[model samples]
Target: MTFDGSWAEGREAPPAPDAPDGPVRATTSGETRRWLRPPWVRLIVLLVAFVLADTVVGGIDQGLDDVPVVGLPVGVVLAALVLFAYVKAIRFVEHREVAELARDGAAADVRRGTLIGIVLFLACIGIIAMFGGYHAGWGSIGAMLTTFGLMCAVAAAEELIFRGVLFRIVEEMAGTWGALVVSALIFGALHLVNPDATVWGALGIAIEGGLMAGAAYAATRTLWLPIGLHLGWNFAEGGIFGVTVSGSHGTVGLLKGTLSGSAVLTGGNFGPEASLVAILICGIPTVVFLRLAARRGRIHPRPRRASAAAAEH
Candidate 1:
């Protein structure tokens, strides 16, 4: 988390955790009109800015995705920028530090999440194997490395956008349950546009990915854990198991193992992300995280008005 990197310009301190109607962790010391500070307003602004940033950055990443060894280091830079984009936006709009992105919490989050993310997919592999869906074979170390780079570029970006921005901001207004629903729907809906996408695939992502990632953040209150989880799963899917990732056929994993049998069990061409087993595999953590969140008093009832939190710059 303390990288060989640093944000050149640090913003002001973030708001108090329980500060009135503003962001849950936004500063209440600023003077801003209520209309300007509504949670809805911040949500729209942040989403717009973040989406634009993701598009530009993602475009850049896609161009370099095939370049082999060069992609990893370059992708790292892009990933850093993506994180910076999230952190920078919070400062610019919320007038508060990004507590969820605190450097101190990053390493711990990765440690807590990465292995579990990998395990989730391994579980999927097990179920698919039982159904005669998977045919194991020798894998390529080179391919695994490629997928690792690919995952690194996308995982952090997706988590920061979904859990860090979309889910967290929405939670401040609608409460955890509402945020889970809205974010999951949107997340799944977005996946509908992917290659070989199906209604089932999108739904699977919603229940398995969006909800799970949101719950992870809800329980941990940081971005790294979700990022780690996302990365681990993607890497395992494409790198370790050599399975098609989210319908992207371009994935070159360590294993060239084939997935055969019923599409229902193997997720067919849309990848394991759409499999029934994935829903169950990813869902367990979602339930556990949500419960842990509730036990930690992380679940909040819907507020009368949205949080008016503005990021600090």
Candidate 2:
């Protein structure tokens, strides 16, 4: 499907008075070519690649489990290898350089601020625990570590596929806002498979999680910021703040907080991610990032270039 911005309002401006106006033909030259493989085809290939690789690794690990020599760190090694392999495969398939995927003008503070956000998120958890007066024992430390590892594995795969590859492809075809909304909707909708997901929860996911993270990617032009933010948000929500990260609660929260007042404020069992507070927390940063990205010309008007050319002639 060709996108000529005809359906996009605010994209068309009045032609200049001296300009010789005629029907303009839209060319694909300015459009990004990331969609050559087709979106669904790319997704299928990615799934097959990861699943096949992981299955082979799992089979090998099961056979060597009794050996006791490499079984302990085997899972971690396999996970790292999978990520590395997937990244390389994606680069090869997409035919785009890794450096091209990154935002060249991103400020260092974007990275630094991500770290600070994680610390602040943890601080919030601690403060909430103190206020709510719930204690989590150290004996559950092992469970927490295991759970963290598993969640990281799952989240990394999904994020890399969706936000990293798919989002960029669509963004290249569609304008920034167009890609942002469509991809963010898909990202949020994918979570419907999670248990106890509600309309509000899904909306929360769309606005707070997907939209916000898309803005982060747009601003930074790298996955690191969004990945860091996502990790911190989930870890703090589930691991530290004693809330469900994605409709699934941790076996033991690092610090516990009772939700006695309001579900809208605290996010009840659906977790803080479903709460309006979460909307504020996530939405605020998203708005800030959106402004910054806009200033940097990341989300500028697309057809404006054509209008400028028309004026020139």
Candidate 3:
């Protein structure tokens, strides 16, 4: 079986105003080129590539857990290589360099995003503290460093997969708003597999990870901001504030903190990321980023089809 299309909306030039209107042609382009490199196909390929590479790197890192001296450096190398796989896959499949991972302005973007993440999480923690649920005491420096490394890897991999691969392609086909909604829902769903994940907690991750982070990516068209933001947020929650990340248990953070209060404020066993305050705070920025992205004309329009049926509607 085969499919045909006459046009791919938003991908090609529109007809001239004076050009004579004609019946939509049954497209041979998509058929011949195998669906004109369908966005869904590209999404699947890229996602598979990134996930596979990341999994391999993770396996290697985990395997080296007992090889004390060479482990960290090797893990760092693996991480870099995993990122390289993403770049390599894009070039190979998309036939272009990934502008999102481009080195230009990366440092500044990462730094800016990291700062925002730290400050935002800190504010959330502070607000929770006001309710007397958050308590902080000194924690292990070594544990903090370890947590930082882990957070960095988590941030990079996640941003690459969710924002870079998933949201980017979805935006190309469905526009920015659609991409954000999709990324958020899927990101939230993924978190449901975490320990002690509640529907509310998953929803919180959807807002923070999907909407907020996706908006940040849409604003910049770069992965650096979301990555740094993810890292900083995770580190701030687990490392500095000594809170559980998402629903992860046994997270060694910078401070030994304790929480005792309503689940709404404390986030229950799922962590402060599930708190209402966090959702509201992060949701506010999501709106800002999306508006900024729109004002900057960064949003992609929905693909148009050359069809009478579509036109009549």
lDDT of each: 0.77, 0.56, 0.74
| Candidate 2 positional error at 183, Å | 1.7
The true-versus-predicted C-alpha distance at residue 55 of model 2, in Å, is 11
**Ten-residue stretch with the least lDDT total in model 2:** 19-28
Off by over 4 Å in 3: 1-36, 56-78, 308-313
Top candidate by lDDT: 1
- Compared with the true structure, what per-residue lDDT tens digits does model 3 show for residues 196-234? 999999999999878989987876677888987887788
In angstroms, the error of model 2 at 141 is: 2.9
Model 1 error, position 296 (Å): 0.5
Q: Which is the leading candidate under TM-score?
A: 1
Q: Per-residue alpha-carbon lDDT of model 2 for 84-145, expressed as tens digits?
A: 77658766666544542233422342344345445545554454444552344442444344
Q: How close is candidate 3 to the true structure, as a TM-score?
A: 0.83
CA-only RMSD, every prediction = 7.8, 11.0, 10.0
Clashes of 3: 3
Model 1 is weakest, by summed lDDT over 10 consecutive residues, at: 1-10
